[model samples]
Target chain A: MTLKANEIKVGDTYSEEVCRNLSRTQIVQYAGASGDYNPVHTDQLYTSEIAGYPSVFAHGMLSMGMTGKMLTNYVGHGRLTSFGVRFTSQVFPGATLTATATVTGLREEGGENFVDLDVSTTDEDGTEVVKGTASARIDA
Target chain B: MAVDRFPIEAGHVMMFARSIGDADEIYYNEDYARSTEIGNIPAPPTFVQAGAQFDPDYFLRPRIGQEWFGSAKGPTGITQRSGSGGGSGGGGGGGGLHAEQHYVYHKQLKVGDVLSATTKPGKSWEKQGRRGGKLMFSESVTEYRDQAGELVVTATSVGVRTERPATSS
Candidate 1:
């Protein structure tokens, strides 16, 4: 359902535990679906010996995809007008993540209501992994 | 990356939604989707990134009869190594890493919509890094258009090439 403009305030916030103990299998699933089979995300041997990382890590887009679920759940299906984010930290396997969206502003344009939001996703340690802003259509 | 024919299929949407842990009925249930405001199963906000699947020259996917970069019988499949760093769309062969992604949706992308994408380089810059050495960042803008040639989504992707493999702090 769409958000009612009268029911939401500028400071309203929504959060979700996007993932817990992220798995290498899930990362592979994302790689298959997104068609980004970067060995750094799936091949532990290569990631450690060649890439020089402790282990394979999640694709930044996968984290963003999980975070987008929080936004679409908050704003309603197919209501987003814009969404953006920066990959602040790398997310590795077994990491747990939570995504939050905070309402920052509301406006009316061309007889339509819209909401602006500040979005952030953090790991178990509260390390911000992704941060950005989004805008979505709302019910007037 | 450029794709001449990227069909938004239901099976692909379901798999993508599931991969992201999204259980929304609208993403997979056709009957439920028909009753929604979008009137059909719509792609998730970040779904268009899958356009790489349709890009024949996408380097991330290992080509048949070609040497891959990931581990196989040994630590790596490729024999010779390049000194170049990694960036966006680069995985095993010392390519770049994805730094940032932004999207502006002109309309809801739904199942059955055929999309074509065209990408152009935007800008590039460099900066010294504390851990990964010099960081080279580049931007690319891609436009997705529907069968009618209507722009459906405009995406800007930034990729960073680190002088060395990034370490967790």
Candidate 2:
């Protein structure tokens, strides 16, 4: 869907919170697909014994990807101009995540419309995992 | 650093989508994707984070003596900090933490695309932390291009290495 710049309202949010549940297998698949084999994400024993975490945890990129899915679904693919995130907390197995994107800025630059989004993801307890912002150009 | 060219396959795209709990059919089924505006399976937005996996000489590979900040066991061996820590928090012989990530898309990445990437350290700075002492920050930018030499995606990630306070042993 193409977002019309004129139709966007600053401070107006789009969509409800999207949620997902974390699993170990998914983490391992991500490790394989992403080529990030750091044991903290795949090996429970290594995480607990070597890394000192209670269990293998999700990669920060995994959570960031989830947020990307949310924003892309809202704005459409290949239309994104910029996306970014700051990793805030560790996500462990079995953690449930919720994410949302809000329209923070809308304007016309060089005759093209753009929308600024404030994106955030939190666990079930409302603790922030990833906090970020994305800005995209709206196709005419 | 240079990331060797690698083909973007449909299966890997699908796997990455599922791994993130995204069940979108366009990322997997070519037939379904063909019906979409993209006309084929295009990777999810952050899919390029896996760009390192495309290269054999990715600098962040974990080794015995290489450490920047947090746990060496994390993907890319970059650490994640929880805001409260002594020197013990980000140890691993000086490993850096993954501070931030930014991506700018010029073109969509689709299946069957052979892509190569080049990464270089960008800006570097330092700032004091409340409890973690002085933090040294650096940015790395990776540009991905298709075989035809078109820019597909440009991803920039920041890392922070901590220096313990004088009080810490």
Candidate 3:
């Protein structure tokens, strides 16, 4: 069942696969869709030769968006009161990313119930790529 | 301040979902979406900010020698790294990075809706970095409203910039 405000506990955690593995097509598609054509994201030569990175990386927004998917999938859409994130590390190609959402706090304000969560994304090796928090309104 | 208008289209929504590796048909397939609770293409939560690429004066545009966070420049006036110190190069302020990002969705934005956005700087501060020296941060908030004047979304994003370390003693 979907998580409702009343049923959620402070320590509840949710985890899901966000991306199996990043590919160049998806990265370029993101650049085309989001209008961020930064060479470091799209041009492998620029990343390896100019930027000195082994491989091109995905945009931080891409990871954040994937994490957002985990929240919407579990809590349901339009329930997000607020969401925030910090870019912790770079995500490279062939890296599988999983997003975890942990409820950190619950509070009542102005007769409304809110669930606070610590959200994060990590690669297969457990390197945190993104970390942040989110708040959602649930039925009391 | 003037409001910048951005339109939401089905094609754009589909491409965005695909870009993020989200295969949910609701974002792309109209027939599949018609049966869902939303009954139409549902734009992803962060979709609105994706429209910023179309804004001529997009806030994240890199500036030279300007104090910036979020992948641009900074206040130090030191542009590129001399490669001697533990410095990351982007020419003075060209290499800013995003420190934090926040989004508050007031309503579900659907395809065919046009959003009007107004953005302004929110907070600016500085703090000591553990190793990167002085860190600069700036925050900006963009409020998106639907055609009916209903506040649809409020997005707050923060960026961090670090001064390049000195090369020589």
Give lDDT tens digits, candidate 3, residues B1-169: 2356788899998888888878776787888777776677878988886776657755434344553222323322235545553123431222456667788878888887788888899999999877668888889888888888899889888877666521210
In terms of lDDT, which candidate is strongest? 1
Ranking by TM-score: 1, 2, 3
**lDDT score, residue A40, model 1?**
91
* DockQ score of each predicted structure, in the order shown: 0.66, 0.42, 0.40
- Order of quality (lDDT): 1, 2, 3
Docking class for candidate 1: medium
Score candidate 3 by lDDT: 0.74
Q: Which 10 successive residues of model 1 chain B have the least lDDT summed? A: B85-94
Tens digit of per-residue lDDT, candidate 2, span B1-169:
4777778888888888987778777887889888888878988889887777767766444445655433334422335544654223342222455778999888888898888898888999999876857888899999999989999888999877666411110
Winner by DockQ: 1
Tell me the lDDT of candidate 1. Answer: 0.92
lDDT of 3 by residue, A84-138 (tens): 8988887887879999999999888999888889999999889898999898877
TM-score of each: 0.96, 0.83, 0.80
The local distance difference test score of each candidate is 0.92, 0.75, 0.74
Candidate 2 — which residues are off by over 4 angstroms?
A15-19, B59-94, B163-169
